[model samples]
Target: MITAIVVALLFAMLVIGTPVALALAVSGSLGLYMMGGTPMLMGILETTPLSTASSYELITIPMFILMAEFVVLSGVADDLFDAAAAWIGRLRGGLAMATALAGAGFGAISGSSTASAATLSSTTIPAMLRQGYEPKLATGVVAISGTLAMLIPPSIALILYGIIADVNIGDLLIGGVIPGLLVTLTIILTVAFLVWQDPARAPAGRSYTLREKLSKLRVVAPLLLLFLLVTGTIYSGIATPTEASGIGAFGALVLVALARRLSFGAVRASLLRSAEATCMILFIVLGAHIFGYFFTLTRTTNDLVALIGTLEVSRWAILAIIMVGYLILGCFMDQIAILILTVPIVLPVIQSLGFDPVWFGVLVVVTAEVGMVTPPLGLNAFVVARYTRRPLGEIFGGILPHFWAHLIVIALIAAFPAIVTWLPSTMGR
Candidate 1:
């Protein structure tokens, strides 16, 4: 009953527009008090903040955020889109395809989906619009492509999942590579199909000469090198994910400096933004730890796992139900918040069913990618709408095809976990 009340209180606070971190902290503390008096709550509060903030793994968040900020400020995203356009712009719906390809490339550097969305919106949407591409197609491609960042290596979403699930952070990062590429390929194919259905919706872009196309590659070489350095180090076991983040940040800093784009203002802005984002995530972590303490005291996960063991349903059915629940929740909540809040509850059950946590981590992020563009609170959709000034309805409608693509990708990963596990398994071998 106490567990039920605490969970109810948490949801009540969320429905009333309470900040997620605060909602978690308050409801958890209240639960702790109800069960074991003020001391238990106080003791938890005193330790959780320190412990959560002090996690060394958490350093990856800020470094990667700062690296992304630097890369954005350096105008590499513009060059990335341009480079992709040069290679693929001659095809039907070519610019839209370029946007997807560039989105995946940008995801290699910037792990934040909304950041990827905003950047693509500024760079690709106008280019597509100027080319006479349909607004719905243009905006939809940008919004959906943005989600590639969530699955790609250096992905903030996967990093958070790793930290939360106590899984190998390196393996999780490596695991995301193949799945991310698969998503990129699927998104491109979706664009191709959309254009094929009505070429008028996305006319072919100007053809580029060999010289011009080759020259564009020069612009992206630095970004490519940076990506190889970061991921290669981790895969080769030369650096942990956290150390690789520092290397990535430093490399981004150097790239900005070499381009003569570095400035006091840019550096300061990057630091401040990184700090702001880091603090927000840390607070969420703190709240999750507090709530987790209360939850563990309730033995909810263990009981839930045991309850599931007695059920006669096939494990696949249970897994599908869980995936469906994530899709529903993804529409209403932030992806990171969903992971932090739900992983502790669901992971044990997943393990009990004989699923690999690393594979499950990749699957979780893939589902979050779908949520980023889903209605009501599709954060990526909002970001696209903000940048393009399109109606939310049109943006949502535009993403309909891509939304189906995401569902298909999710289904593929679920059916063949090897897609997610293969590359990671090869790491260090």
Candidate 2:
């Protein structure tokens, strides 16, 4: 009865066009009231939001987001993409491939999929279109590849998952490294394969001189340094993810100043955008906390855990089911909201089945990354389509290959947990 009310209220609020955070809060409150009456509901309402927001680990989110904004405003994305294109654009479908690689590079520091998609789309789509790249392919690649932001280190989703699930943030961050690179490489290979199969779909070549390539290297140097400085610090235990984020944001500001791109107007705009995003994320998180508390009060997670234990299926099969559920949920909900809502229920079940939390977090992140490129409700796809002005259908179609690539990687990681665990284990994190 509690579950039904929670689901109904959540869907109803969404249908009526409430903001996601407010909807989560309303639905959670409804569930709490139904299960424990007004006292429980009032307690949750008074305390949950503050508790959720005060988490020290979550501080990484705004810092990473601010770093991305500064990088974009500083014109760093433009330089990175330009350098990427110069090196790869000569090959068939090279620009598209380059966009994926560059998106991965930019994602390392940004850690926000929407921001990466918006920045990359604004910079690369026009250039690719001018170069005679297919609209669907160009926009699709950018949209899908931008999701790397969530899978790479410094990711906001990973941080949230770590905090909620009590997994090591460093482990979750390192766990993503190999899988993220594999996905990027898979996208590149997919583009190469498609172009090879139908050469006409992508124009041939424009080789650059050695000097030209070297000249462009300077353009992407700041991005590389920033990535290494932030991720390297985390890997070396020199700083916590939150501290690394602060360092990254500071580095980005310095880069902007060095490039003479910093201005009072730009600084104001970046802060405003970061604050808006941070508030939206925090509200959803707070609502999820209330909802999670409500679930606990009703013993929903406990009941669900018991129900899963009684199932005859193997744990691997159950894991597959959970991944599929995330894939479906990812379609309708934003990544952070999905994590906040589901992890409380799912993590207990996963641990009961003997799976590692860090590995599971990576799996969840990869699946959610796919949701970013999946149709109709994919925020990244929408951002790309809006920016490129391409028919939404084309962008959706273009993402199919990359989507398959991500699924393949997810399967591989599932089959061989070492892929996700090796780095974190090696670091003793």
Candidate 3:
């Protein structure tokens, strides 16, 4: 009952618009003090923030964010969209497919959903609109395709999940590649299917000659090559995830310089943005640690695991329930906030069911990706709406098809865990 009340208070704070980091800290500290006393609260505050914030592995977050910021400054997203559009510009709903593809490429480079969605919405949605595509298909594809950023390699979500779950970050990142690619292809096929069912949704895309496609490819190839070099080192056991992030950040700078777009202002902007983002994530991590410590004292996590184990239901059923819970929660909260709050709570049950942590990480991430496009508070949907000046209702409606695409890919991964695990398992780690 006390555990339930603490959890309820936390939820109430979030619902009332309290900042997540602060809510976590206040609720957690209060819970500990009430349950254990001032000594306990002080101990948690003293150790949790210090230890969680100072983890050596935590440095990877800022490095990756810096790299992504630089890549954004380099204007790689525009080139990616142009290249994908050129290569696949003739099929029914081809522009949507290109958006998905370009989103994937940008996800690889940027490792952020909002960054991918915002950039693509501003760049591709207008082009699709000018080509006479339906608004739903145009805006929906951009928003849904942005989800690939959270699933793909160098993902911020995967990095945090790995760190929190105490899994090997390299293997966790590699594990995402297949699942992410599958999600991308599934999104393309969804667009194709939607257009096939209603050709008016996307009549046709502008055709590009082979030469034009090849020429456009040059704009994005260097960044793709940079991604390959950095991630390749990680897969080949040549660099840790941290080192790879540093390499990626430097490579992003080089790519920008090569494009003659690098400037002191751009670099400075990237640094400041990355620093802000990094600080926010670190604060959230510290708070989650303090909160997680309170859960340990309450024994709520252990009790929940035991309770679940004692149930007559199958593990798979329990897993489904968990997934559904995530989907529901996704509708109401930011993915990062949801992860920080729930992962520590449910991880014990997940492991008790004998699920692979890496695969579960991918599943958790893909589920959260749905939130990025779902209604009421879908961040990506809002990004699309803001850029296209479309009604939020229409944007939400447009997102459903892409939401189904996410469901289909998630089902495939669940059925064939190897779909997410094979690549990472092959790594030397």
Candidate 4:
């Protein structure tokens, strides 16, 4: 009964256009009322948001976000994309491949999927279109590749999953490396395959001399340094993820200053944007905590776990089902909301079935990456479409091959847990 009310209220709020965070909070409060009456509901209202927002690790989110904003505003993305283009743009469908690689590099610092999509789309789509790249392929590459922001290290989603699941944040961060690279390689190969099949759409390559290539490297040098500093600090245990983020943010500011891109106006704008994004994410997290607490009080998660345990399905079968469910849900929901709202319920079942929380976290992130490219609610696709001024369908069609690439990589990760676990485990996490 409590579960039913909570579900209904949540859907009702969503359907009526309540902000997602508020909807979660409202539904959670209603669930508490259903389970423990008014006083408990009020108590939840007081404590849950405070507790959820008070997390020290979560501080990394806004700092990383700020770093991304500075990078974007400071024109780092353009330089990075140019560097990628100089090296790879001579191959068939090279621009698209370059976009994917650039997305991976930007993902390192940005950590936010939507921001990545928006920033990269703004930076790359216009150049691709101007270069006579097919609108569908160009937009698709940008949209799908932007999903990398979530799989790469310093990802806000991975960090949140670690916090909620009690998994090591460092391990979760390291765990993303292999899967992230796999997705990148898969997307690149998919682009190659598509270009081979449809030669007309494949533009002739632009040849660059060795001097040109070497000169372009200068454009990306700062980014490489920033990557080393952030990921290096974390992996070396020189700083926690939060401290690494702080260092990265400071580094970004310095980069922007050196690039002569930093101004009082840019700084103010970045801060405002960061604050807005931080509020949206933190609010959803707080609401999810309330909802999770209410669900626990109603014993729904425990009941669901017990019921699933009674089923005759194998653990892998159940895992497959959960991934499919997340894929469908990802199409309509924001990834952060999906992670917060579902992880609490799904994770217990996963653990009961004897899966490692670390592995499952990576699985969940990769699945959510698929959602970012799926249609209707695919935030990345929408952003790309808006930036390129292309029809949504074209962008959707273009991203299809890359979507399969993501799926193939996901399968590899599923079949071989070592792919995702090796780095983090070797790190002794």
The numbered model that scores best in TM-score is 1
| Model 3 poorest ten-residue lDDT run | 221-230
TM-score, one value per model: 0.99, 0.97, 0.98, 0.97
- Per residue, candidate 2 scores C-alpha lDDT tens digits across 46-144 of 877678888898888889889988988887788888788889989899988889888898888788899899999999888888878878778888998
| lDDT measured at residue 111 in model 1 versus the true structure, 0 to 100 | 85
For candidate 1, write residues 151-242 as lDDT tens digits: 89899999999999999989998999999999999989998998889888998889999999999999888998899778889999889999
- Clash pairs for candidate 2: none
What lDDT is reached at residue 315 by model 4?
89
lDDT of each: 0.92, 0.87, 0.87, 0.86
> Tens-digit lDDT track for model 3 on 370-390?
988887789999988888899
Model 4, runs deviating above 4 Å: none
